[model samples]
Target: MLHRKNTKLINKLSTALFLAAITLSAPSHSKPVKNTSSPKKVVPAADLSAEDKLFVELREAAKVNDVAKTRTLGSKLESHDLSDYVLYYQIKPQIYDKGAQARVDSSADAAVEAFLKVNAGSAIADRLRNDWLLVLGKRKDWANFDREYVQFVLNDDTQVKCYAIQSRQAKGEDSKQLGHELKNILLDAQYFGEACPEAAQGIYRAGGLSKQEVAAMGRIALENNYEGLAKKFGVDDPIADTVKKARTDPAQAFREFEKKEWRTGRENTAAAWGVIGQFLAKKLDRNAIKAYRLQHEAGHHQLLSPESQEWKVRTALREGDWRLVKESIEGMSPAIRKRDPAWTYWYGRAQKELGDEALAKETFQALIEQFNFYGQLAREDLGMKIHVPKRVIPDESLVKQMSENKGFARAVRFYDMGLRFEGNREWNWELRTLSDKQLIAAAEHAKRIGLYDRAVNTADRTKAEHDFGLRYPTPFKESLSPIANSIGLDSNWAYGLIRQESRFIMAAKSSVGASGLMQVMPSTAKYVAKKIGMTNFKVSELDDMKTNLTLGSNYLNMVLQDLDGSFALASAAYNAGPSRPKLWREKLPRTVEGAIFAETIPFNETRGYVKNVLANASYYTALSSSKSPSLKQKLGMVSPKASVLSELP
Candidate 1:
């Protein structure tokens, strides 16, 4: 039943090697060395203007994904007029990266790993959870865990690989020794013809083999099972007795496992069931799964009867079975009055449906006030209009829309048209969810087209929110605060643009080839690379500190000049491409808000990008303790009566 995903992995490996090769060959274009200058010292914390210090520290903490420092610093920076990049990445970076720092906490990591099945990739079936890797490691460094894992994989050359596996052997967790010896034992057992190469002698010389430990481990599914696993490793039955005993008590074992308080046996059984689900006799497996799925689907399983209906409520809520979820929860016993912090939202949902309007309002109000994404969802269900993911990655048609059609290209046009028309009679936001496009690509397409409002709203609504915002918030700030004053470009406003443009993601790429922290186009980055008299530059590494900031700030500085020192015009130029923003002036009937007013902008991405920056500037202002720059300020809409083009020198 083990439907191995190994083949797909091989294909991906091939692609990665190919791309990495190209990236290496193209070295001259992306050598990120900005100057001959020494790495600048971070400014004296003593000299930072108080608000700048708070945000800088928050930004510094976010560089390493330090969540605690972010929260603490955010509390202090509350008065700074800064951008939301501090919150999106600084406060919660993984929410965007899908938690890809490859770090984790123990309990939550276990839950997420259990859900993910594979250790890591794009998070799917991945629930939001606090990392648990550190806790599971008892606060040990990940390198320790990596070392243990490496030993299991590469036992030979052990001395070169690491310190002697003396510790694991002494602790009797000698997986490396077992894996190495077991492999030799296996090939010898399965010898068809050729002699086997000597096994990689491990750092841990296998001490007196513990037949008992190997026997005990053999049947437990530790995967490192020394004897029976040797079957896969090609080992002869050193002790068939262990397998015999386990087989004899299989039913009793299942029962006993079901009874374990820690639910260990239940987990073993679930894995067995999962294997069965993958590779069983078709008729038998289908029938069993059909029965199980039917029970779960019909709302009639022991997992959720009247007495234990709360589980059913949670189950339905988790799967978003709204129609039945509300009914099931409300029907639960009145005795089950309280809810866990985790379960409180379901209670609120039930209350809303029971028409207990006031109580429902209060419960949800408190829920959202305390939590963020889900609370936002509940508040919106109460007519507050918060963004939430439906948790469905596009099935197929959406993939087609992004990959096969003019879907991505058209999306930009449609998006621009929509944003320009937002708050106008023609702006229609909901046309997209039904448009058979992946929301991520669709949002980018919207940005390309100039539907600023639509792009912002839709991007934030989907699980792909960061896809649109990832460019600016992430790498720029990480490197920005560390070297901002020296690198220059008001860090406060830089943070604002980073937040406003791509929510501060260095790697965020629009549908167009606008790349890096500042959304510099790939061509533009190439030119910047040449201008600074440095050679190597990989497009992907644009998120790296020195190159991204150097190019980004220079671009910003140039835009500022052309825009007559107007941050709004510069930002618009940044979004629309500076030349286009400038040329559009003579081409379009100028509104007071510049040629590309929210309603008139032709390129969707620049249009929405401009507005988002303005909105984000307001939020950033709130965070950075700077005066919130008004919308008119961003759109060149100042003095609603006066035209910017008329004032242009």
Candidate 2:
């Protein structure tokens, strides 16, 4: 999977040859260079405003864990109307350093309670409440845990959810409804850690989880390489042994699995088939054909977990076995069968292949309501044109209203001063009380102010009256399009990628120091500059739209050709690196649909990136073209690269 040579060679070739050919004659354009001048230093702490000096000292005291000093400083700041935060500084170290037990003993929970009483609706108070709940949960003080848990406003923490479920179960109140909800919450959890497994075990023992469910969960854990989790589930020895054996010799493992009672008992038989499906999916065994036949013939498909059944469909898809694909999709769980567009699209395809036009059209009709990647493909299936949603024009009155709002004004000021976190906080707080119409207005205001990312983010929160233009604006079209076109690349695709990369923030800089429009790495920019023969190129030039786009497009084109014309693979290579996608491709048993390939990628970040990029590209295509685009055509198919073992070290 190492792309060390490819990375180095790309840098060199991009800088040395590509730029050399065009740098001198490159068109000049006006793109803003961010002002990097250092800010003026504050006056000495001794001479600062009383509130400011106290704030500075309190922060330092908290950092060094000087509890006495923090308390003293906190007391002095009490009159400044910041007692809650000051109290937090004095108490935070006790919780962080010494453990929550001491904090509880020291009546730290009482201080948190007082803070919450005053700042009842604040995010900080909610956080402190969550922290205290964790301490109470640790102590197994279910009384206080139950009392405080109800007040924790968001109730979004997974660990807290597990603890809450466990507390409920301890009281012998594990209702069927509650158990089902808890099961859904923890179903695909990769690691149960401590709380979740404890909760799951209680649920399992209470008859909430059937034997089949336990085995399926165990298989999933083992497949995910979370052996500790598999052990936590306490699966039968045969299932556990099969999991281990399958890692080294799957065919032999299946043979061994068949000899056990797990293979025959009604409760265990379904899970046994699932385990075999999981194993054969990885192996891409031709025996999968027979496995599918058996799965259908025995009507065991209904028992397979969605994950197991998915692999069955994927395996069938890889071998281009249409009948199995149709059967497998039909046999999936109702939720998976009805809700997942991937399966739905393939199901429709399978129906068409089986000469059932009426069913195929019915399936395609349900998918076109949402304008996503699959929607585009579904539209093609129905012979309908793919057209972009109409742009929602900015309301000048709303823009003025947003501009006049004190909170948004503060956000603008903070953003102008390069305090993005504070700016974002203020912006979000302002948004908390706004109606959907007001939100659209705010998004428009954000767009006007060059905060395209924020605009898109804010717009994304609206559930009704979607504004596609606001969500998918192409701000740097004039500069970006030419570069993409010069490289014979689709401008829409490049824009979609840039939208995802930095959300059109011209001066955006990632934590890893990837700068500007494309988030190009400093090293990448330098190598590209050198390859293109830009003798005096400065790293700061990366912040300029014109330079960054040109270099980025060149590098993208290089990787595109290197990886082949498949945008799905090339996009993955772009985000990760060339060798990673190559390694991922080599793992596939045969050429499979790109959507299937994307779903199976190991890295969660890369998988999401590939899907979003493809989806985004499809949207952009519809936005720019009068004719409907085929997302499936863009995705194409992926095959294993030819074995080049001799070339590897």
lDDT of 1 by residue, 1-649 (tens): 0112332443333323322322121111222232211122133246456666666566545544454456567556433433222333232333222232222332223223332333222211111212222221333344554443332321332221222233343356655555444332321122211111112122113533333323222223221223433332122233233234223443333334334424333323333322222121111122223222323333322112121233344334323345455565454433342433334565676567666778778777776543232353455556753322233433454534544333233233322222112122112223334432355555554444444444555555543223424121223355676545664555656666766655444445565667655777777777766765658877776766567777777667666765667666677777766655565444332233331243234454665566555545544443444453333344454222222442211
- Stretches of candidate 2 off by over 4 Å are 1-107, 138-153, 170-174, 190-193, 211-223, 227-238, 244-309, 326-340, 401-434, 506-515, 537-545, 583-602, 625-627, 637-649
- TM-scores, all candidates, are 0.28, 0.74
Clashes of each: 58, 6
Per-residue lDDT tens digits of candidate 2, residues 514-629?
Answer: 88888888887887777767889899899888999988887777777776788888888778877777877886768787877876665658877887788887778777777666
Q: What value does the lDDT take at residue 603 in candidate 1?
A: 52
Per-candidate alpha-carbon RMSD to the true structure: 26.1, 14.3
lDDT against the true structure, per candidate, is 0.40, 0.68
Pairs with backbone N, CA or C atoms under 3 Å apart (clashes), candidate 2: 15-530, 15-531, 15-532, 16-531, 19-532, 20-532
Query: TM-score for model 2?
Result: 0.74
